[model samples]
Target chain A: MSIDKLSGLRVLCVEDDPDIRAIAELALGDVGGFDVKLCASGAEALSVVDDFQPELVLLDVMMPGMDGPETLRALRAYESLQSTPVIFMTARLQPDEIKEYLALGAIDVIPKPFDPMTLGEQIGGILDRHSGTTGYR
Target chain B: MSVNDVQASLVALRSKFSGRAREEILFLSRQAEKMSEGKLTGAELSEAYHVLHRLAGSAGTFGLPDLGEAARVLEKSLKPHVERLAATGVADDAIAPVEPLFLRGIEGLFGLVTDQPASVPDSQNKTVEGVDDDSHGTQVRILVCHQSADVRLSLVQGLARYGFQCLEVSLTSPDLAGVIAESSRVASVFVVGEQQLEGVASECRSQNVGGRQLPVLCLAGHDSFEKRYWAAEAGAEGFFSEPLDFPRLADSIERLVSERRYRLSGRVLIVEDDSDLAEHYRLVLESSGVEVRLVSDTRHLMQDLAEFQPDIVLMDVNLAGRSGITLARLIRFEPRWLSLPIIYLSSEDDPESQLVAMSEGADEFLSKPITDDYLVRSVLHRCHRARQLSELMNRDSLTGLLKHALVKQQVHKELASCRRLGYRSCVAMVDLDHFKQVNDTWGHGCGDRVIKALANLLKNRLRETDVIGRYGGEEFVVVLPGCDVGQAQSVIEGIGRSFSELLFFGNDEDSFSVTLSAGIAALNDFSDGDVALEAADQALYQRKSAGRNGVSVYTVPE
Candidate 1:
């Protein structure tokens, strides 16, 4: 059941932590009921961007080489991914920081230590709110 | 991803990731040691922070909150100096404080690695489902306050359809207020045929407690006037007869509990010249439940900082006529915006210029044509880190309570609130009796445990809204926002009694109980928080002069 929070949604998750990555995988794929792709790092995520053609990118804030925001910038280089909603999943939550993430073009910031059970709902809720907005894939 | 599958995956990942997580901390610590010895280059210092940064961000998620927390503190403490070195090519003089912090982080990891007993496997702590404390915001909990077990069970089942899957409390639970306060915000409280609703009712109506307001409804077998009157008098918002208008009741519960509002979703102010790119960014941010404002002109950024109050700044290094680095530096010039994160979006990949921009006050430098994911993640991390560091600065390193100044400030705010609301508030001064002797006799480690035990007692005993602060080395001050002198004294006395009962172990084969003395002052007795504090301190002094382990109230001097 691929629910239509954002129409025909496909999500690519990039995280360095394997545990978090797996949790996100389940949250996005199983609980969220969406077409999902998981990548270990920003570099791997960038390599598969065109092939996966995800409508949204769920990224981790901290990574080994090219971090999440750097990867977000790289994703925008592709003509196909310019307007995609990028959500950052991070353990670090300070209100100002969330605002900063927004300033950086991320549609949302998901606090890390995220609940796998409600993770899908949280993402879907964000998608549902933004679903009506124009110019979003 | 069923819940079970997610849990299974978590259990599996725990085993896989722990070894690597250890390596991650060890590597960062090694770099930190190198930096301490003045060996790491400026680039290496920045690199060290990033590696620790990743570890800090992930360690908590991997069932190692202690390691994650240590890494977080280490990352934040090292960041400013690292940024300074990255920018100015400054030597290692600024890094004097960083080495110890790095060593401390390494020590925390080492503690984690060595803590497991020989008999227990590593897998025991790794299971997500096993931890009683881990509530991951999954099942919906409804606290059922009924005097009958069968009725409680039935009501629990009735609400199951609407997704109130877990029953937090039943008829046997003595204090509904305590249960509700202890649990992660119960969705609703259904009081079935109960006459006295004092505990939960006080909790539900109280603005001072600060727990999420749960709708309280009463259901009785008879629609008698006395029952309805009692329910109304008891502060039940809704009353239902035996047949139980289930639909109407469900509607009320939904209206009260499920209509939860979004709390502080991210807000952004974009300072970029590219109109199309700005629009794209705005849409993306807005879609993810973020509030976005675009300003192509950089002339009035101070005004925007006041109004929009962005957590992170996203601007191009080369803007229209004005350099983004210059703007970043200007922003940092103001004390209020010093910690405001600024991420520079530039097309250049040159490391030297990046360092210059960083030196100029940019928190991060992202090359242009940045992927949507990369841009978002950087902004998020910078913003979060800045906020966390500021928060950490306000907290005590030992007891994890508010620092002295913050406690006094909180008392001032609460006293002002007490005046406006015309409610009684009280301040308490808590001091351990014969603490120095305990420290001298049992050594500092045992003394520390005794201090921590008291703090934990205060946290457990006090309400969430009540402000607690570590006022001194062995003293704590608590501001009870809405508590009168009597209520405050009883609460303090309860803590004192419990603390005296607690047994703290000494160095070898000896263990002894620690007793604490407390003094309470009412807001009405003094003009401000400081004055109230002085009165409380005086009362505390009196308690110490008399037999210890007693709680004394301040009397107004004529």
Candidate 2:
């Protein structure tokens, strides 16, 4: 896969904490060099997913209203986003909990307190591996 | 955007987050109070849980790990309560039992937030400018002399991991002595093959770096008592037989470098009320480069301890009007001075009195009319042991850096000194980039090596007076006294660059390198050490956001 596969990629970040949301924007947009959009909550993400048509969605698992899995399900309801890769960013990464996230069709889970410096590369690697098998557009 | 702009934005965002977190904690406290008063319904309980859940998830990401962990514990504890309230409807009894628990959790969480040094608004004007470039000249250099090029290259590469820049010189060079003398200004340690040890040791013994003998480490092909004896006779401080254990060699080199960096003299506080005797003891200790403070009045013992911060105390059993045993007991009452070594001085050699002095927190009892040599030896040994014990207790075993609490205390102390002397100081938050990936990919052992390598780098590169601490796993807090933010940025940037170049070997031939990102904040800019450290952390996040392997100085956004 090309290294630039992640560059200029349209990514949506959904986090309730404004500080974390801003940091994610910088990580994905500035450091990762990806086209990024940030949404405060699952509701905000749902409202923007169709129009933005992001290539990837980075969802926070424990949001206040309409959490990550619920938001993923809601986004999957949109016909266009059914096969779109969604990565869950979470703090809780117990084995069983990770299984639950994967069962919900999340491409992978990037644990919280992530290295903002390499967030984009991490997402890119995950996408590269998943696309090899699933071949999602 | 420029890296500086991004860094500034990140700092602003962090302070904003701190402010918002404070408000959120306040709100949570109020909700807890409401629950205690039976005024909270199911909605409030759920809202409180969400607040805690948010804190648990986000606090660590913002560099508040303690807060995040505390919030996580409280959130986990409150999960069942929230679920029960949601499932059973508004039952007052269901919430009653959790009221106290919820309140205590809120208080603990609030303490974490408020413990952040209140941000001082006007201190921004005092940010120091014009940081001299020469101040960043403390990088450790090692001179390597070996017969084989392969051995030289391997040694250089291995030493580089410990942040030493190795200058390789051919062992057959006729000007070996001249090279040693010329490199004395830069090179701290000399490493040579066992075959070349005699020549290198003779040359290194004559060369000194900063008034100390250059340490020599010999790499031998085989281990033997004769070779060891030969190396020792030739003045080699360390002998490592191949295959070389780089970590062990690095540890020895680090210890030697630090010892050469600063040879701190012992400090003794004498509580002898006898004017003549106290003066005599002070003169005797001072002759051996030991700092001595004599207190004629026992009434000022506590004040003296606070001000002097002595390594050891010498108390005469008989004071002018008070008992020295009582004074020793008083010193032991304060937990901070409990580790201090106290020796009683008494003319009477009664075994019972000596036992009594030992019982009242005295470490040793010395009979009066002792020779000056005996006093110096006893006091110096006690002082050295006390310092070593204190360092062991206050240091992280893995990195040999100050533990988290001690680092924070050092920052506070530095800030106080900066404020008093009107000098600049900087607190830097340094974290290894993608450290978790290192652990997951190459096992915990390799990860530990990486952390240790970084610690060695920081210890070797920074000034001797700088206080370095392992704040958390793969996170370090460095307090740079008399350094402005700009100076710290350059120093830390150098470290970050060297750290990225270091390769850690995993199973098989897999080698990976990790980078570091550091954020620095001027101590004068923040109200207290915690706020200053937070600012530094915010700057660190900024560096991470702008890409890793760099340093960013925190600038207050206009």
Candidate 3:
């Protein structure tokens, strides 16, 4: 189950909370096995995305200065990051939230307080399903 | 220590260390279990999920490790169920056993903490959702049922901020429409909630609120996708969801407000053959803040337009033996006003003819019996755009008055007709007494204000059509169309008095007004406007040497 699912997977995590970032990084790295980069806010994520060239972005829905949806919209316009897999992790998503997020080109939504052990595996499954037959190489 | 004091202190220690946490945990556990049983519906499950998420966060903050762990588990279990229900529209009854597991865990921690254990009732109790009696007073005439109280309050506050007199009621009531009907002047109804659409619709119909339609906005709840879809079908106007995207909601409100359109403040020149219809247009347009000037004959059309420089032209399509469209084409051919927005206010219902009229240079082709909103919208849409262009052409930068060319073209025909009728019209030439001395003493800014102040004084005192123009430099001219020599002198005398009394500019210790020397001359013997104007100038020169702050009338008798 040690899928290099995100090994050199180039994942960027835009979360405000250090604890949440620690939780996400630990979950994504320890479980998902991706090269996860963490930024504190949407603004920082926008600034640093050029240096990272992240293939998959785990974006927090609510963050100070720019927020998640605004960042995603700005990110969509960039030629380099247009095809990146974006998964929204939000504490506030009602059941109907998935459709709106998916419509905005998010690969999937991960509800918060995600299982630290299976975070990478779940993201790997989603990437695998979307990339089609890649099977988390 | 006394025996009673020792016992009380020990009890206090037990309560502080253990009892409160245990009681709180047990109370929450029982409440959670009861809600989770058969009592909570799919929608309530969504609410319970949100409540538990907050509880879990708080429990971690309070160091209630076991209670936090149980809350976390409950939150996790509810998420998938809510999501699955949203996707498949099916609720799994199998998740019922997970409720007891969480309750047992929280209760076990409660037993360890407190001396007095809080008892958990095993039997299920029914929880009624959205059935709380509205504690909000009847003063809240218009009830808004947003999912959260803060959002509803913010919207209410915003509306109140903009001077929209309204009321806000509680969201806990199931019968939202019934609460809305209680207002005497429910000028509009806005329902913004995601519950009981049928009940809301019936209440709207049963109220029989005439003319003013209640605007209904349903804010979609998590489990109410069908309600969001069928809400407007149930007679609601706007459908939104939480976090309640205010800009989108505001746009919808703007449309509703536009539907009940605002009064248009504009000027319209109506050209019609029928005197009654012309008068009717005048009354309608004037009541809606439109300064209307009607010309019943085609002969007076150019004069009216030149004088009024109206924002929009409302012409009757069928004029005296000619179509209004032909007249509009003729107007469009003029280089000075090639882009005038002419609207044909006609009874013709044919779309092809309407198109033909528009092609003939009419901006709008409005049908007769136009609604107040349609009329206001049409006039405002055309006029507001035209005003931007006219501002450049009409404005005089120096004195902030209408330009000489524009004002002359306006007052010329009025002067001609008034002269012909033996209406005892008078022309006065007013010169600011020693104006160069003023410019030299007070600088140009003060001089400008003095000139502006005099113009304002004359405009404020005299009738609107009594034409006053800056006849170059400190000299001004006023054409009194219906005034004889005696009346003109009195009018100019009053102006001279008011002009000398006005406060111009003050520099700390001193403030002073400007004075004017004017000469008045009636056009009794003279027939031409230019010759009458020249005679008035000679009289003004005599008044200047005869000492300033006085009026002199021109007379041939010597």
Candidate 4:
């Protein structure tokens, strides 16, 4: 069975930097043609996840308070989002750090300075592979 | 929305980011001052780290890669101090050892932010000198003076296909010399019929654009030895026979125009420990319009090489402690820089020592106590020759683009940069659609015209930073740094549409158009350059199978 393309897929992005957030908005919303909800912090992302029912989460690794990992732990408490895939974006991605993120249940890790034009498609590709292994809906 | 709209928005967004970056730098500098004064808190140090981290992560995306790199370096150095401060809840004593370093780093970052003169988007700023106009945003113009209106019309229309906008210079003009002189400032080349060749050529010969003679190409009524001789005597740089072959004529004009453009000054890196001697070399080279960078510390030589990308290296035979020969060998250890010319400066007149230095990767040895004139002449000559040799080795002669191996190597370098700096880039594989049919239908000449046309189009449209290569017979590879596959697809599609509109003349009176197909793969997704290129090729195959003349991004099959 082939997974469908991720066009119009709902995604929640959590990033603290306003400039990067604005860039992500243009990349995912205008370029990627995805339904993207941007949150300024992990706390805001947790608040919006249930209502938005996003298919995927893009979490920045570092934030002022309640960072990415803690946010992921908090996010898993939601029953609907438990199985939803999450990807971490970070500036530093050492091999061990990647292992740690994967161990924390991140489907993939995207480095910072990501091409805004292809961010949505990259996430879609990540999701397709993740679903292939887990037989996710 | 169109790709242009997206690109425009990105430019706007980048300017906004730059403005914000200025304010952020100010905030960081204030924090640095507080730290230096021993009044900063642990939380404030953490804040400074985050600011630097954010700058490192996003500056390149906003078209400030150098600034981003500097920030990354600073962040890496500050990471340990920040972590220790967080653990100990003490900032002043913990950071006292590196306070001066932090202050200098912040000052450097501030310099980088302020040094740039109101940033113009890279695309707009990097138009090739001879090909584009800053005011009109149009192709290089050619002044055409022909006796017959029909011939002028044909010439104008034919040259338009080759990206030249021809302005008609009527033979009936009262002041032909004045007209030619005035137009010579804007036009790159003059294409005149044999009837008016002598007058126009003479006027053009007397005219100079930026101190170089304006080129004139003569269109002869028929091919003859006397006509060619006369044309050459009349100051025409190029001669084309009647029944014009547009491709060949345009090719000649292009070459002449490029040759008329000023050649860039050679850059030389001087690695000398003697401060006085280094300053002397710098002054002498600078007077001759040579860009000179001096390095006193041998430890930073590699970093300097990577940053400056000089055309040649001038080193002293004896450093304070390090041997110049050993340093030359160390530079040659990297395969990428093996071709760089290294000239040693030494007072050692022994032929045996000079030969020893030459064997250890030194290209030439210049004895000390040399006059400034000798130094300038030798360095400039060597720099020019080295550049010429490298271009011959690494570029495809037809397209003036990187050869397949060099482009592949570029992909690997960009991928490694992406991994280290957390940036994203894309590799695109482009092939002309139905190119075989084009060759069979027209001829090899027309086929070559199509290839050259596409190459010119790519060069005109893409950013200067993008690496374009002639990968195969009719296939080209373009590596776009800091672009996603989506953006690459859009850009390639735009090129494809423009390419299909281009007209190529066949042997007969008729002209035909050709189309191109392209596929893009995000560089960071694949493990290496070869794998990424293969994936892009696979996508190209898929596009060809789906009917050509389109762009596709590589997607994984679930």
Candidate 2 has a DockQ of 0.11
lDDT of 3 by residue, B535-555 (tens): 888899899888889899998
lDDT of 1 by residue, B1-558 (tens): 345555666656655666777676677678767866778777777876776777666655555544565566566656556766767777546555335545655655654431221111122222212111222122334556667667666665555433334343543557554445433232345454564366667666762232346656787777889988988888787888655443345445544443332221456778888766776666445433355678866888888889898767887777878888888889888998887778888897999978877988977777888765565555555655654565578877656689999999998988888888777789999999999999999898778777766765565455556789999989999988756788688767866776676555584356688899999999866677788899999999999999888899999977
Predictions in order: chain A TM-score: 0.87, 0.92, 0.88, 0.90
After best superposition, candidate 3 residue B31: deviation in angstroms?
58
Best candidate (score: DockQ)? 4
Best TM-score goes to which candidate?
Answer: 4
Give DockQ for candidates 1 onward, in order.
0.12, 0.11, 0.01, 0.19
**Order of candidates by TM-score, top first?**
4, 2, 1, 3
Which candidate ranks first by lDDT, i.e. highest?
4
| Better candidate by TM-score, 2 or 3 | 2
Tens digits of per-residue lDDT, candidate 2, B1-558, equal 665565565556656767888898999999889878888877877898888877777775554555776777667656656776777775444455445655766777754552232111111111112111112235566778888888888887777656566777665667666556545544678888988888878766664422456788998998999999988998899998876767668877877876663354688998887776676666556644577888866777899889899999988888767888888888889998888889888886889867876988998888878887788788877887787787789889888899999999999999999988877888999999999998999899888888888888777666567899999999999988876676677777777776787666676466778999989999987778888888999999999999877888889878
* Quality of candidate 3 docking, DockQ: 0.01
Clashing pairs in 2: none
Candidate 4, A14-129: lDDT as tens digits: 99998899989888888777788999999999888878998889899988899999999999999998988899999886789999999999999988767565566556656664
What lDDT does each candidate get? 0.68, 0.76, 0.62, 0.78
TM-score on alpha carbons, each prediction = 0.42, 0.53, 0.35, 0.55
lDDT of 2 at B300: 78
- CAPRI tier of model 1: incorrect
- Report residue B443 deviation for candidate 1 (angstroms): 0.5
Tell me how candidate 3 scores on lDDT.
0.62
RMSD per model, one decimal: 23.5, 24.8, 35.2, 13.0
* TM-score for chain B of each model, two decimals: 0.49, 0.64, 0.42, 0.66
